[model samples]
Target: MTTTAHAPLLETSRALITSLQEPGGAYPASPTFSAYRGYCWFRDGAFIADGVSSAGEVASPSAFLDWCAGVVEAHRTPIERVVAAAAGGAPVPQEQMLPTRFTMAGTPGADEWWDFQLDGYGTWLWAAAQHAARHGLDVTRWQPAAGLTVDYLLSSWDRPCYDWWEEHAEQVHVSTLGCIVAGLRAAADSGLVTGTRAEAARAGAEAAMAVIHERGVAGGHLTKWLGTDAVDASLAALIGPLGVIESESELAAATIAAIEDQLCTDDGVYRFRADTFYGGGRWPLLSCFLGLAHARAGNTARAGELLDWAAGTATTDGLLPEQVDGQLLAHEYRTEWIDRWGPVATPLLWSHAMVLRLAAELKEDA
Candidate 1:
């Protein structure tokens, strides 16, 4: 049960995330990667904050949450407008919505990128509530921003934007819906919303869960999209920390089994089959996710093994790459991405965060 072997690596991961965190409390996707440089994603930062929170570090995530509050507040007027328009049967253009990522200074990036994803906003709500509850902090501090986020989701939750991979903008991804459900449920339970707002949040969560059950499931497992039978590793989060699917549920079990049988490799897990980004190598973060789901489901031995594989993917300096280049499904396309984006992202904050998270789970269980 001893986790002493991981002590140094875990500490190193913690230090890496802390060191790379921006002065404005944003965790950059990576310090110097060509593709993700200078960007702070709500989805990535939420998971990163959760990892730091689990390690019992409060200030970093608190600052990040405060930054999140500011970002949400800045977009409040637009979000309200969007909601009003939606209610009037005039939905705003997807491009007019708040972006998935922002600069470290808390403004939307001017550069062209995939900006329509709603999952990040939902993820921030969930992560912020989790941090507040875990630390016994006041949720009211971020309530206004959380309200804005909830309203935005309520207006646009049904719209298909982008998946976690930033592809398939035309499909209603199960992972995206799962994130909204988790966030709304967390906000509803945070004691920050009341009366109509609380009722709406709860009702929204129920409706979203209904959609997931009705259309997001296939072959007894959660599908990548509404009509597709494919599985994405991100779906694992739904059964773990996301709680969109109960860890002990039959559906959760089937999803995990499918991921293992199809996407898992010797090094780690791929984002999905046919992933060509960075040659579709095994992702350290997704491995941590599957491990986390296993840990939550009481399969500690399997979780530990996955965690060990993730830890092994780290460089000698203890920095984890976004993915390792083994078991690549698209080796032919590797050179194209490398030529375009330089090397694959090294020390990706999300990867390190997942490693820290899985390590903490093992230590706590031990």
Candidate 2:
């Protein structure tokens, strides 16, 4: 945990966390400064706090913490809106991955894809629950948001909003449902949203997962999407967070093992599949989550190595790019949408948080 050389990593990471925040104590979804009135999102909330938590007080993700608490505190109204929106023939938040503000709230300019993910609500639930559990905060602090999130997931999982790729869909994609399941499982475990809500979260996650297992398992590996034989590293999110897959399930073990053996580059970044998508680019978040998958499954040493590799791709400025080419360490930028502000910055809050969570493992292993 006490790496003599990790000082710069910690310092840079802290600096980035400080920069990513809105002055009033919220994250603006992405660093992609925009004119369209951006707000915090499920993805941002999860990772922004994660990054700060990992910075080890070198800097505080407290801006993130304040944002989460404030938003969670305000949950009663939004939850009502969310429920009303769903009940009144509004679309169920299908996991577009936005925080409540952008999801239910209106956006003027281009707000598509990144910020309005309905599945993101589930992630918000998961992150809040995890934040409460990890920090030993009062679980009740997260209950309502967590509860509404779970209810939302169950009420709308089968319906379509947006896939992880942000494409509208009725077709089941692995990333969407997987994230939903992982997030809900987080809510259920948080001890805040229990009983029916917890059961529903657990069930939704399981059901979505069942869809994967029944149809996804093929040739001795977990397939990426339902009915498609794609092998995506994104599945790592489910296996990493749940901890259920790694311990007893042969499929989880084999799937992760396959990812490490094939998808993980020598430098530790993850390519979704070397043969497909965005020129077979390496995904930083997926790589970090791979480390978590290992760690969550009790393979600390392997996790440490993968985390080390993943850390290499982070810029000297501490912003984790969306992709770091494995063989050559090529940095790839996925431009977020344009708005009144101009071209968007892709310093995704999720990537920062992934690094932060990885840093937490360092302390624990120490």
Candidate 3:
């Protein structure tokens, strides 16, 4: 349970994340990867921001939050249109909706991508509220955009969009719903949202939770999607910092046990049983998520074990890769992706962010 040995790695992870962050406040998915090199995803950046904030780097996350606010504000009109369309049960074109990742300049990327995901917007609200509360700052600055985001979620929360892994856009993902619930609850509690907006958001969160309970559960654990029984590593976050599910709840325990049994290896955790991205290598971030869930459940010894395992996956230079090849389920497909997109992303900002997050959790327990 000792974190003394990994103290240096903790500092290194924080520094690496800070160094990779762009001056304009974007945290690139990876600096060298051809595919993710120039983009900043709200899902990734929110976690990264929360990590830095937890590590006592408040300004770093604050800047990122400001950038998010700007991006949301800039797209206010479009967001309203989409919300109105959804409310009226009219079809909204995917191209007209808000995008998932944006350029460093805070504009949507011109390049083609799976850009219909709503989880990131929700995640950003939750993370921003967490930051503001932790640092005793005014949440009002983010309220305008946050309100738009809430409206969007209120209208479209039940729609099928992309999941955290940016795949399966046609299915309603439980984890995606969890993110919306968490975000809505956070926004409602921020003291900035008022009147009908506040009431609607709170009711929306409760309705989302009811849906998750009725359809997202399978055999006591949260399923990957509403109709299926498969579990995903991302579900661990529901019981962790996201607080969609209580860390001590029976459902949370079952979900964690499922992840450990089905997706986790001695090296790290996989996205899912059928994942083939980057040869389905064990993901460093998911390991940190599982560690965080364990830490929240008061399993400090187990949590420390996961943190140590994640630290060991770092390269010799202390850079954490997005995923490791150990126990790769799709080993046959590794070379294909490498040839197509170059080597796997090293020093992935999200991976380092999760490392910092878990390390901070362990340190707090220490």
Candidate 4:
């Protein structure tokens, strides 16, 4: 799992990510994938930014963070309006809120999508802080947008919206809460906000964690959402990359074990047991996420196994797809999506980013 051992693919992933980063600093979800082409997600880009930053590439992630700040600043009016409305007891329609993805030019996408996800905003805050901290970069440049994001999240963190997969828009997802908590904590610690904003960031993060402790945990591990006992592959992220929950803690250990037991297989990890998207194929990114969690928990051997499985999913050309067809959960739905979107998204930036991320973790551990 050392970077030296996987230098070829790791180098290819790094080059591909940097090459695909839009001129505006936006990282397109995928360049050739039909549905994802021309779009960048704050959530995906933040994770990708962290990956790029982790690989010792500063300028790439810095520009992405700058782009994220610019995006929030550009829509300051709408973001404040939504926050004020929610504060006054009348939440605006979901459509009026900020979107989940945007054009590489930093504007909202022209086409409609499950666009109201809150995790991305929080994720941006987290990534910006992490990058600045990792490299000792100045953080003040992002403070204005960070303040706006903290206000927006503090106002509406409890509202139900889309999950990471853009599904179940009606349920408040636990993974989303983890992102918010980590972001808020980062903002509070980053010296990026001051006065009331910083105070609110600390309090908001604590409140979110309280909610998770009271309602998000079930059967000794984190649940998919507040009321459900179901686990999603995403919950593993809370332990490692996000660090909302400590990796060595009992809750983190149990959550990782639950995901491995119920959702993981020899191929990779499934999003959830009932997932049907892309025939519910194993995701290389999710496997890397679980591997990261394991690495943080001091389970290097298991982490290496997960990384190898994910690496095996790469094409001969070293491109990683959004997910693979191995041991699909709902093979029946595969053809329909292929006919609609044409083959799975190859060279998914997030997949390559996750591989870099896990490899970095293992390399450090080694």
The lDDT for every candidate, in the order shown, is: 0.89, 0.59, 0.88, 0.92
Candidate rank order under lDDT: 4, 1, 3, 2
The candidate that achieves the highest lDDT relative to the unseen native structure: 4
TM-score of each: 0.98, 0.75, 0.97, 0.98
lDDT accuracy of residue 341 in candidate 4: 92
Residue pairs whose backbone atoms clash in candidate 1? none
lDDT of 2 by residue, 1-366 (tens): 356345566566556666656675666656554532365565556666655654544224444544554555565565566666766887545443234354213222244443345556665566555555556567675565566567666766655454544443655666667667767787777675788777877887888778767876776667665676656676676666544355446777887777777676664645454333333466666777887777777787877776676667667676666555435322232221222244433465666567667657655321
Candidate 4 C-alpha lDDT tens digits along 208-312: 999999999989999999998999999999998999999999999999999999999893999999998889999999999999999999998899899899888
By descending TM-score, how would the candidates be arranged?
Answer: 4, 1, 3, 2
For candidate 2, the per-residue lDDT at 213 reads: 74
For candidate 2, the TM-score is 0.75
- Candidate 3's TM-score reads 0.97
Q: In candidate 1, which residue ranges exceed 4 Å CA deviation?
A: 364-366
Task: Give the per-residue Cα lDDT of candidate 2 at 55.
Answer: 54
- lDDT tens per residue, model 1, 247-315: 999998999999998899773899999899978999989999999899899998899889889889888
Weakest lDDT window of 10 consecutive positions for candidate 1 = 357-366
lDDT by residue for model 3 (1-366), tens: 434667677788788778878888888889989999889999999999999888888878988988898899899899889988887889597777789999999888888899899889889999999989888999888889899889988998998898998899899999999999999999999865778999999999999999999999998999999989999999998888798899999999999999999999894899999988878999888999999999899897888788888889888888899988868888989999999999999878898888888888887421
